[model samples]
Target: MLSSVLRSLQSLTTHNNEHQECATPGSSTARDPRKQVLMSSTTFSGAGPSVGKRLNIDGDIPDPSHQLPALPSNLPPPNATYEHSTPPQIPKYINAYSLFLAGSIEMGAAITWQRHMAQFLHHLPLTICNPRRGHWDPDSRPQPSDANFRTQVEWELEALSNASVICFFFDVNTKSPVTMMELGLWAHSGKVIVCCGEGFWKGGNVKLVCERYGIPCVNDFAELVVEAKRMLKQKGLDAVTDEEIQRDEEWAKGIVARKARKEA
Candidate 1:
């Protein structure tokens, strides 16, 4: 009975060893079918490699370090048409003109001149001289009673000299003393003076001064711009098309000459 029990125990031990060998693979054995299926499904997809794994497929990913080279620094600046040995001289014969819109600061003529000048000749340098309390403050107020009026006058004279042309505006029905003074000053200084005054300004001090100084006086701002451009070309500071300049000059000259003929 004891020998029989020992044989039964040995048989049971051999069966248990066989079961353990089937449950766990040896070190050199291949992966199990379940593990191979799981790894293939999780690591390989149509969207490339899995998030954490490096892709092993042929021609699947690009190297990230290579990039296009930057442009060179010796390239010329854009929109540079010409390079001059010397700076182009400021047109002396009135390539740039300033407008001295002179009238009562609150008047319609002043407003009209400002609007038209801003619209038509916006590119030109214009200086409107209408002093007001708002423009004068603690920092830049003018001394009314100061005897330094000569200094102001000289400064204005210098501005006129620097500018190739000057323009003045006045209202015929209501002439401001300050406007008249400015017109007179520009006229006396021999600056190219163009005046835009009311139609009735024909037989007044403004008209008389314009006539005496040979200053071109017009009743319209549009006509004033045409005349100013023509004068610039006549003085040889403008190199624009001759046909255009001549057409404008003919129109202005016709108006002036006809007016003169009618007066005669």
Candidate 2:
């Protein structure tokens, strides 16, 4: 195990060196500052408010309480989307909720349903943990030795841990083996809501697991958003601070009103 970890660290060091050289000043391949810092060193020892304890180069890669507030009717909720390689911290705000998007992302070929879910839930106090790489190459198949691929996996795992809710979708067009594995990991955590389309190759197996675990399972994308939002709102109400409720009393009331009406 130690030997394998050393090898992965070495691989990460080499990848970082290459990235550094290519991103030199005046180079056409230069990346932005955040990207530079994120890929800075194999050690990942950078110190910053957002940067936390070092995750291994192998790239394996929060709580609150309060009365809550009423979400103002007709008011949009505060939200943000943290893409891959970005800092894992959700926006530091009262009543914030985090949702990790897990599911089919077959090299970006699978439907861009993530965007749809983000848009649909944008009106809530939520942060979307989206793992889709903004500049990924579809043809570059991921391998164990690829540091970038490992880093992406690390980010997703970290995001999943930070999430108050995780939404998984199985698109019928692709075989998402990784997503299936993720479901296995989080099925009993009570933080997952799955949407497996009927036409998916593993729909039956997925449904069986959901049933076994008593997970909230839906059959389509729309329902996934609906259920995920419901879970987020419930969590938000429980975790929002007294200050947040006072500051956004109207909005908080709106949230409570909406929930009451739904229950009614």
lDDT of each: 0.39, 0.56
Name the regions of candidate 2 deviating beyond 4 angstroms: 1-95, 137-141, 238-264
lDDT of 2 by residue, 152-209 (tens): 6677787788888999987676556567767887888989998886667667778888
State the weakest 10-residue window (summed lDDT) of model 1: 34-43
Question: How far is 78's C-alpha from truth in model 1 (Å)?
Answer: 20
Model 1 ranges with Cα > 4 A deviation? 1-109, 123-157, 172-174, 199-203, 246-264
Q: After superposition, how far is residue 96 of candidate 1 from its true place, in Å?
A: 6.7
TM-score of 2: 0.56
How far out, in Å, is residue 241 in model 1?
A: 4.0
> Judged by lDDT against the true structure, how good is candidate 1?
0.39
Once model 2 is optimally superposed onto the true structure by TM-score, how far is the C-alpha of residue 58 displaced, in angstroms?
Answer: 26
